[model samples]
Target: MAYVLWEFTILGFDPTSFMFSGALIAFSWLLVNNRMMDTEALGRDQLFYATHDPVILMDAAGRFAGANLAARDLFGDEIPEHGGSLRQLNKIGPMLDCLAATGELNPAESISVGDRVYDPRALPIASPIQRRNNLLGWTVSLVDITERERSAEALREALSRAEAANRAKSEFLAVVSHELRTPMTSLKGSLDLMFNGVAGDVSDRMKELLGIARRNSVRLQKLIDDILDLQKLDLNTLNFELQDVEPTEFLREVMRDCEMHAAQAKVRLSVVSDDAEGRMHVDPYRLKQVVGNVLSNAVKFSPEGGNIECSLGATGDALRMSIRDSGPGIPENAEDKVFGRFNQVDSSSTRASGGSGLGMHIAKILIERMGGAISYQSRLGVGSVFHIDIPLAGGVPRQSSPPCDSVPGDGEGVPAFGEVRG
Candidate 1:
């Protein structure tokens, strides 16, 4: 075999003898690999310093090694220089200790520097080479969140103001309703006396005029009463006298009371109580108001000659009452808003239907307060069904004490619409 020879210098000193060409080529490849590794390390350092977020590097001994321009601006002259211990730095030392113990990249911690809020995070750096896989320290960063905190504080204040305004409005309505009811009661009585010819015999024209006045006065009185009830509900002062009563007979009586009004609307009212006989513990007068409000709506909305059905049934442990009316169904968009205060399915219908738009809302509130729920299903042009579900008296635990010998009043001493006789 032909002998191969190599010539090289060792650290600027000439070699004493020639070396094999294969050994020379191998040494050249090692130098090239080491140079490439150095270039990669330099590139990584450049990227770390270029980042806009404050980046700080620390040694495994918890001493500061380096920091980017952003870190200098954030910490100002307080930034540790050279191999200074991080424990000596104010505000930053404790945060660094927590990060070191937890080894978390982003901890739920914030630091307030002057008027600014900065969210601090730390990530441990490690050697990339497998053989040198050693802890290199940490890279800490800080993110500003001052604007976010300000926005959150503003939202809290706005909610507080809104709640205060609503309370004030409810109080104003309660006072005004009480003030108006006194005059309305007197006006209604006076008009009724005139219509019944209590003053004197009247001509047909005078009687018709007095009858109109009587009806309008009655409507106004009802509106005022509804407003007062709504105000009481808002203030959480509405009282209930729970009593055990027959559901079928009670529902029949309510239907019967609405018959005269339904007749005037030319709508036929029907009740179907199929095997629904049971005693329900409920406040009878409040129950009546709930049923009456629904029944009245059914009468008002039902087309002439259309039939309105009231159904009562016992399903499982609950008593369910449903009122089905043959009227223009509620629009899809307005369905969810029906139980909102002063909400109406058809705004123009309020005038024709003779309502203050509080009937359904009040009914819902009363039902809910009595531990029940009300919902409805409606199809456009096909009519609607309103359902109330109340747990049977003993089926669910009572939420409050039974009506005492002295019933709690709403401070106004207003008489509710039910007989108190047991």
Candidate 2:
């Protein structure tokens, strides 16, 4: 006897009624043939046939036994006849062979049908009997991933374009900075000479105007230098002369250089080197520039009579340098913005302080390029502390030390330094 396994419900027949008749026919056939029925497998087959994603069932012989509505839609109305070899279907034969050999789907393999891309997966159906746990057939599911693949391709293209644009922008900035430097240097020198009475003695009013011009010209010159440095860094063209340097001597030099600025701000500068034996491998000039930038910022923000402390110590194959400033601390929300280019904690405050908002960003880039890391800790009412950690030369292990506090001279009293103003 022959029975219809599936009928189109669109053809004026209720799907529930057709399913009931099909089930009754299957049950009667099993009883008449004196064969045992697997109700669990039958229920699973019914559910599989109702799935929205295309599902195909193949018997142990690799012949198509059944397909779902989605599968019929995918393959067209003329699906493979019952017991027909699945190899006849396009791009499905190799996947079936892979599944038969490995008993699992190859996720990396995919099939393209028309404009859609599908990743095929296979699962073996085992016999229900405990003693005979053998493979009865296989269930293949095709998951369409065309949209996902397209989205990934689009993202890769966008990333490539963004990188190209960044390279172009960096190159443009480098060229523009070089062109502006020559004229700016000449203008600044002329202004400086006039202000200093080198060009000729002038009236008090004229001297005051020249002084303003000189100061602003100097500020502009500094901004141009910073832009050039940033561009060089971006292009990886900045040169470094790496050498072993003693931390104690290095800290002393940096502290000496910072004293002028600290004095100008009425902020005392002091250094404490607890572990002075460690040597750092870095470009002294570049490292000093990084340190100077941090010191300048500290001095700029620090209130009069407040102290700026520089400390150096060793911790596990790395040398740590921290700058502590008694200033209005960085706000919680503005902490992260400090390292971003042209970003300031408060634009109005930074403008009044005469900064281009690039000092901290440049310092961060310089430290990172020298194989060091820069970070800071701050509180709203207290003060701010910036730390730089650089690995020691020759990878020598550092001597164990107590955790460095965020505040320099936390327990130690601030030492006195004689007045040294710029």
Candidate 3:
């Protein structure tokens, strides 16, 4: 961030006054440099002076009234001590007129005199009356902004180059991932056929090796698919076919897809879904992708013979389906990091789960794009529950979104798994 972006202050000489360091100086914000001046009333209350910056005073007649020592040094002969008017100061005059005309001084319109540029800030000294508002000349402050503009321009250029590089990288990844998919699918199929004795009978040792190869090929294919999806998401090119879907029906269909994986992990699956018809606008494919990632994670982490429960209900106006897993729960502080790309709680090489850590990150983004959100709550010795919330079609958006991490056994908004809701 730029220094100007910070809410900063140049300490005023007098402790009683506030200086406008990071904002425009209106009538109430005129602070002087505390240096006494012979400019009479114009410099009496320290209103026409600056310690380092140039501050100028012009009479209501548009003639230069007075300038402080700094302003004198900066403008030199252009200070117009010979009663020259505001219209004679070359660029500064027109800039002031343009600013007053538009009621805005664009940063790009700063006065560039020789090698230095300055942002001209002006405020009309005035007094209100019954008939007509009175104008008491003007106070114009010239703030040197050469370095600030240069730094901003450089930062903008750097950002442009970085974005171009990132886009190219995403394009390359998408192409390579697509190309690798066909060969990976063939490799996995061939391994399966060979293990099944398609090329004559295979020994037990040969079968074991083929199993390892096949499993790895499957893993590799998943990585490729995830990378491609991630690229599409980053490029904002992924299309979703959104349609109204009934809540319970959607969960049942997704359950079937996760059934085989859950069974292989020696885990039981159950649903406590609302049988009543309800509508949720969502992209079926994207929603499935989200549920699949969460379900797969649950399966990988569940203890053998453990149970994973899926529930569908209305969490406010939105439909929420929470998937609870009977695994060692995540730490309470791990909420934010859980959805961060390429991040993992157990990052050690000996960690049990194997993944590129892009699943939850991509899932979070996809769910959000569908006017929904994903959240979780966990207890160390108990388990973790992932709450996937999506707004019902044509329904009001959720307001005053409460905290997502509900305390289990605390009798809160939603109860923990194994605890029935009334």
Cα TM-score of candidate 1: 0.74
TM-score of 2: 0.77
Worst-scoring 10-residue span by lDDT in model 1: 401-410
Clashing pairs in 3: none
Off by over 4 Å in 1: 1-53, 102-107, 130-135, 235-243, 330-334, 349-351, 379-382, 396-422
Estimate the overall C-alpha local distance difference test score of candidate 1: 0.74
Choose 1 or 2, whichever is better by lDDT: 2
RMSD of each: 11.0, 11.3, 15.4
Ranked candidates (lDDT, high to low): 2, 3, 1
* C-alpha lDDT score of every prediction, in listed order: 0.74, 0.78, 0.76
Q: In model 3, state the lDDT of residue 211.
A: 84
Model 3 residue runs over 4 Å out of place are 1-52, 67-81, 95-109, 123-136, 395-422
Can you give the lDDT of residue 405 in candidate 2?
50
In candidate 2, how many Å is residue 245 off?
1.9
Tens-digit lDDT track for model 2 on 1-422?
A: 01346544646655676777899999999886654346666877788788777888887667788899888888874467898867757677667756666676654587897788888877788888855748888989888889998999999999999999999999999999999999999999898888889978889999999978987887898899899999999899999888988877887898888787778789988775446455899999989888888888889888899988777765557787878888887776565578889888887763568778788888888888888877777665567777777767876545555123555334543322111110
